[model samples]
Target: MADFNLSLFDTSPFFLTGIPGLESAHIWISIPFSMFYIISLLGNFTILFVVSKEQTLHKPMYMLLCMLALTDIGLPTSVVPKALCIFWFNLTSITVGGCLTQMFFLYIFSGMQSAILMAMAFDRYVAICNPLRYTTILTNARIAKLALVGLLRALLIVLPMPLLLSRHPFCANRIIPNTYCNHIGITKISCVDTTVNRMYALVAVLVFVGIDLTIIAGSYILIIRALFRISSKQTHQKALNTCTAHIFVMLMFYPPFVFSTLTYRFGQGIAPQIHIMLANFYFVAPPMLNPIIYGVKTKEIRDKVFKYSCRM
Candidate 1:
């Protein structure tokens, strides 16, 4: 029970305690992160504000888009600010509670983003696969209900991640040297065993990322099948057009999602800096890209953006 001995855990596991090797490379990463943070905020905020201003965009699809923009806006904003401070400003000290708080929001936004995207996919599936029911199915009341449920669902999925981390005791010498405290990173600081926390981590990743991906794939499978059976080129073209933005978004979300999970599981200590950089990008890239991908590819949004630009 040496681990229980106070001196043995003066900090946490030697490897997991705090990042070692404070060095110069962090500065290089910080500049890009700072610039990207601004871009993500402006991009997501513009989508949210412009969509809100246009009465025409108050429909289900746009409502979901706005909700998505809000979620996207927060995801990176939660992680990158602290990361930048650590990299550039040298703010290395974080409280145990503060670390858990950061982790909670980070996971919250990530889960919410996936949930919203799955909702959007369901929206498209209805639009293309069952056009007649699209109106009745995605009414404003239902959309509102879905948003509330999405918030609650995200809360439920992410709840265990931070709660599990909080239960782990942080011995003194709390110097998490990275930009922000990640969920697993904070858990690593515990002086004791955490099989329960690790199981929760795996379960959270599977449920939110895993199940969301499965549903998205299923939605598209049905959509593609319906497209093939349709006879008219014009109708097919229109249906295909609606999918363009959604497909673009899925492409952006999954790469970072898969890579981050793998790197976290297998890449620790082997290449800590590269892994840290990937973790940073995982949180930052999706929010920044979502607005750009959806706005440019979506015709209605493009028009609304133009109208908003003109009004401004």
Candidate 2:
């Protein structure tokens, strides 16, 4: 039997399995996955382009939408291309440094998207709860500052992850049985003690997702209570209508995220393939669905999309 704790000093390439327990069907699976990649890229890029060129979109809400589009583009861009290569071309080997780089970008961008969502929630809260003062409250300067703060927060929170993992000696299995270099997935294969990494991972999740979710839920709760106080049905409907896209997009995001996180933290007995599938869904689904939800629900974006489509 091979020793599980044998530490090697040489830097060998880690083999990445595209999706465990379904390696034989990777070619077939890559079809929808390819479509997802195409749609995600095209959709998010179109959102960025449209929001940038249209002067009417230069508002706090759309500014946050642009932030979201960028993060959506980034979150999947960090993982999917390498996954596509693994699925289609059998390119599974990645160096330790390379894997660490991928892990860094993945965590940072994922955290960024969550932060952007919180910002969007705040935007809606201001718009609905304090309608007359919306513009005064969320000025361009404040929006810019919020965006910068979000990026900085994501950086500070996820920065420790790669550093912690890099110092650890990996003497166990070099084969990572998932599409991308996830923090948990990579750390599990390390030979040395990973308790610090695990603890910090929990801390990162709590600080980012846990705290953000609480704030977002609080904002919406206040918005809901304010809505109930208004006597006019037309005003209530109009206010709710404005939030439809954000609400739908949130639905597309958090459930899959919570499911994947739960599976990762607690579902050790779950099949590797299931874990990989949920992770892929968490990465791929939201980016592809976000623009679609906004385009369908928001009249301004929808009309602009149609106008641009006709011109081109």
Candidate 3:
């Protein structure tokens, strides 16, 4: 009986499902997925390159933009290649170790992205609300420290996830109904009681995302008040323009993220394929759109892009 029970809890390889009911169209789907991946790579790399080359773009806001670009690059790169493999070659099997590694990177980058967005919100708040002391308050050293903090915070929060998962023995049904591994998805397949895992996941989301959103909301509220105090219409327009890109990027990121997270836990009536597609979109859309939005909205980046294109 003991050996039989052990066999049932064997840590076998997990087979990832591409799209729950859309397996027939995976090859066709890969085309758009490939396009988005390529665009994300080029767009984010361009942001990084433009920022590095332009001396004038060395302010705190641009520095934070660079961090955002890095996370954008990481967020999709963690999942897309493996997804492509599954779509193109029918290679859907992922080892336990491999799945955990993917989950770690995916969540770490996601956490880092949230942290960076929060930092960027602070940057905008300072730029708008405390323009005179902005340089002094957000010096290069301070920016570096903030970046380090973001990285460390994400690492600390996500490190235990895989460790927790590693201790749990998976059941015979090792099939994950998604293109990639995530904490909840992996936890759901365990035969053992996963109340602790679910609780931790909820706590992590609230602590990381909830706090960040609160800070961002507070920053924007102060920013709006500051703008209102500036009676000069032109000054208000200029200040508001500076924030449009970040606001658009936030819109690109948070809504889909919140929906996917909530739907996964609460939307049991939702189709599995719908959940899977939304999850994939949550990873893909922000990375692909962030750079494009920034490039179009920020004159400096747009100007640099044009200059480089002219040279090429």
Highest TM-score against the true fold, candidate = 3
- True lDDT of residue 120, candidate 3: 90
Question: Which segments of model 2 are wrong by more than 4 Å?
Answer: 1-10
Model 2 scores worst on lDDT over the 10 consecutive residues at 1-10
Strongest candidate by lDDT: 3
Name every residue pair that clashes in candidate 2. none
What's model 2's lDDT at 281? 64
- Per-residue lDDT tens digits of candidate 2, residues 232-308? 99999989998888888888887777777778889989997987877886788889899888888888999999999
lDDT of 2 at 266: 95
- Which regions in candidate 1 have their CA more than 4 angstroms from the true location? 1-22, 268-270
* TM-score, every prediction: 0.89, 0.95, 0.96
The lDDT of model 1 is 0.76
Model 1, residue 293: C-alpha shift (Å): 1.5
Candidate 3 C-alpha RMSD relative to the actual structure: 2.9
Model 3 C-alpha lDDT per residue in residues 1-312, reported as the tens digit of each score: 333334224457899988989999999888888898899899999999988998998988888888999999999999999999999999999988889899999989989989999999999999999999999999878998999998999898888888777777787889998899988889988878888888888888888889999999999999999998999999999999999998998888888888888899999999989878878877877899999998999998999999998999
Candidate 1 lDDT, 108-193, residue by residue in tens: 88788888889989999999888999999899889889888878988988876765555556655455545577766665656678
Record all residue pairs in model 1 with backbone atoms less than 3 Å apart, i.e. clashing: 83-179
Off by over 4 Å in 3: 1-11
